[model samples]
Target: MDLESHRFISYFLPDQRPELCHSATIEKFPPGTVIFEENEKPDALYLVLDGKIEFSKRGGLGQYQNVAWAEENDFFGEFGVLDGQPRSARAVTCTSATIAKIPRDRLMDILERSPGKVVLQLFHHIIHYLRLTTEQYVNQMVHKHKMMAVGEMANTIIHDLKSPFTGISLANSMLKDLHQDEETQEWCNLIQAQITQMVVMTEEILEFTRGKATLNQKTFNLGESLEKFQRLNFIYWNQHNINFILRCDNIILNGDENKLMRVWQNLVGNAVEALDEQGGQIVLIAAKLGQDALIKISDSGPGIPEAIQSRLFDPFVTYGKRGGTGLGTAIALSIVEAHGGDITFESQAGKGTTFYIRLPLC
Candidate 1:
C-alpha cells in the first residue's frame, strides 16, 4: 500500500509489525452508495481516504435527518468496533470516495502485539468520544428542564395577574355600554369578552401546571354536565360556525363536575379551533363499554401529523394554526389518569382525528 493510503498506521507503535497494514485493502464507492446501515455489524473499520460521507437516522413519522458528516482522513465505524455493538447510524457517500478497510481480527492482533502505544491511542480516542457524547446529551436534557421550569413560572404569574384583569375588563364593558352608542358598545363588548376568555384560559393553564386538575370523586349525571358545558360554550362554537353533535343517554359517572367540565372544554375548544373558518363538525358521544364509561370526541378538521401523534400528550408538543402551549392534552391525560381512566387517539393527515376516554364507573 502507498504510504499516504496507509495513514491509519500512524496510530500504531513505531516497532509494530507491518503485517497488519499489509492485510488491509483500499475500496472505492460511488456517490449515493450506502457504506453501512443502522443495526448492521461492524466487522471492519473504515478510514475515509477521500470525499464525504453523511450519517443519518430515521426520525419520527419515517423521516430521515442527517446528524453528522465525515470528510477526508476521518475514521468511521471505530465507535461500533470499540463498543462491540451494531452500527448506530446509516452512512451514505455524498461523493465518489476511497476508503481503507481494516479487518477487526487483524486490528486486534496488532493492538495485542503492541500493547503500550495501541492501548494508549485507543483509550484516548474512546475517552474523547465518550466525553463529547455525554456533554451533548447533558446539554439537551438541561435545556428541556429549563424550558419546563420557565413554562411553570409563567403559568403561575399569569394566574395571579388574571383575577384583577377579569374584573377590570368586566367593569369596562359595563361602563362602555352605559356611556356609549350601540356601535361603540358592541366593540367594547367584543374587547371585554376577549379579555374574559384570556382570563379563563390563563386559569385553566395554571391548573394544568400545578398537576392537580382532576375530577372530584362525586356522583354526577354525565349527561347533565355535558349539556351544561355545551350550553355555556354554545355561543362561542356557534359564532365560529362549528357544528356540535352530542349523542349520549343519561349516564352517571362518579367524578368531579368542575374538573370533568374542564376536560370537555379543552377537547371541544381544540376541535373548534381546528375547524378554522372553513367550518367542520365536532361529535361528542358517551356510551357504556363493558364496565367502564366511554366518551368519544371526533372532529372533521385536518388531523394530527404522524410525526407528533406519539408525543401529542407530552408537554410542549402542539399542532394547528393556533400554536398551542402544548399543555391541553398533557393536562387532559393527567386528569384522566388521576380518575383511574385512560385516553387515546387515532389520526391521519388531511382526514381528521378522534379521541377516546375510558373511565371506570362507580
Candidate 2:
C-alpha cells in the first residue's frame, strides 16, 4: 500500500518515505475480533488496508451502539494517539481485515528527523482535526438551543390554556347539578373528559421539558403491576382492537412502578401508531435473567424506519406522525435510565420491532 495516496497517512509525509514506512507494521484481524475497546490507551494509529471495521460505543445494558464504520483506506485512533488520551470508542473487525499499525512514538520520531515536508504535513493534519472538532461542537450547541426554544414556547402555551380549562371544568360541574336531562348530561361528561385529557397532556409536556425523572422505588410484583396497567389502558387498547398477550414470571422487582409503566406506555403507544387502525398483537414478556430482570415488548406492526434508526432515542427525533412532540421515547429513556436500567431494541424495516428493557433484580 502506498502511504501517500491516503489522506490520513499522507498528511504525515509527502510521499512514501521508505524510512517512515519501515517503522510501521501490518497486522490482520479476523471477523468479530475486537481491535481496541473504549477507555483503552491508544498505542498506535491504524490504517485500514482491506475489509471493514466497526466503531461503536457502549449503550444501555451490555449492548453496544454503532457509531461509524471504517472501510479500506480509512484511518482511526489518531485523535487518541495525538492527545495521549484513552480511546473514545471501541473498534472491532466487521470482516477479515488488514491494517497498518503505525506506532505513534516511531512516527513522531521519523517526522521530527525530516525537517521540511514531514513537519509541514503534520501541522496541516493537526489544524484539520481541530477545525472538524470545532464544527461538531458548534452543531451540537445549535441543536441544544433549538430544543430549549421549542420547550419554552410550549410551556407558555400550556400555562395559558390552564386558566380557561379550569373555568370550563367549573362550569361543567355547576351545570351538572342544574340539569338532569340525559343528552345534556352526556355533553357535560364529554367536556369534562376532554378537559381531563388536556390536563394530562399539559403535565406530560412539563415533565419532558424539565428533563429530569426521580424514581419512586419500591418492591412490587411485576405481574400485579401489569394487571393494574392493563386496567388503566384497557379502554384505548380495546377501542383500537389491539391484543396484548402478557406472559410474566411474577418476579418481584424493586423499582418505580409508575415510571416503568410510563416506559411501557410509550413503547406500546409507538407500536400502536405503527399498526394504525388495522390493529396488531403486542406481546409483553417478563422474565428473570440471573440478577437482572428482562422485559421485552414485541409488536407485529411495520417496524421503525431506517432514516432515524441510529438516532431513535434522541430527543425531538420523530417519524411521520400527526401532532407528535417527539419527546415520548426521550422521556421514556430518561425514566428507565434513572432507575438504573438500560433500553435497547431490534427492528426490521417491513417486519416488526422488539424493545428490551433490562433492570437490576433486587
Estimate the TM-score of every prediction: 0.54, 0.59
For 162-242, candidate 1 gives per-residue lDDT tens digits of: 778877887886889587788777667656655645655555566665555534489988888788667667778879898
Kindly report the root-mean-square deviation of model 2 from the true structure over all alpha carbons: 10.1
Number of the top-ranking candidate, with lDDT as the measure: 2
lDDT by residue for model 2 (19-101), tens? 55677788889999999999999899888888899887787797886656778887788778878899988999999998888
The deviation in Å at residue 51 for candidate 2 is 25
Off by over 4 Å in 2: 1-131, 157-211
Please list all clashing residue pairs in model 1, or write none if there are none: 216-256
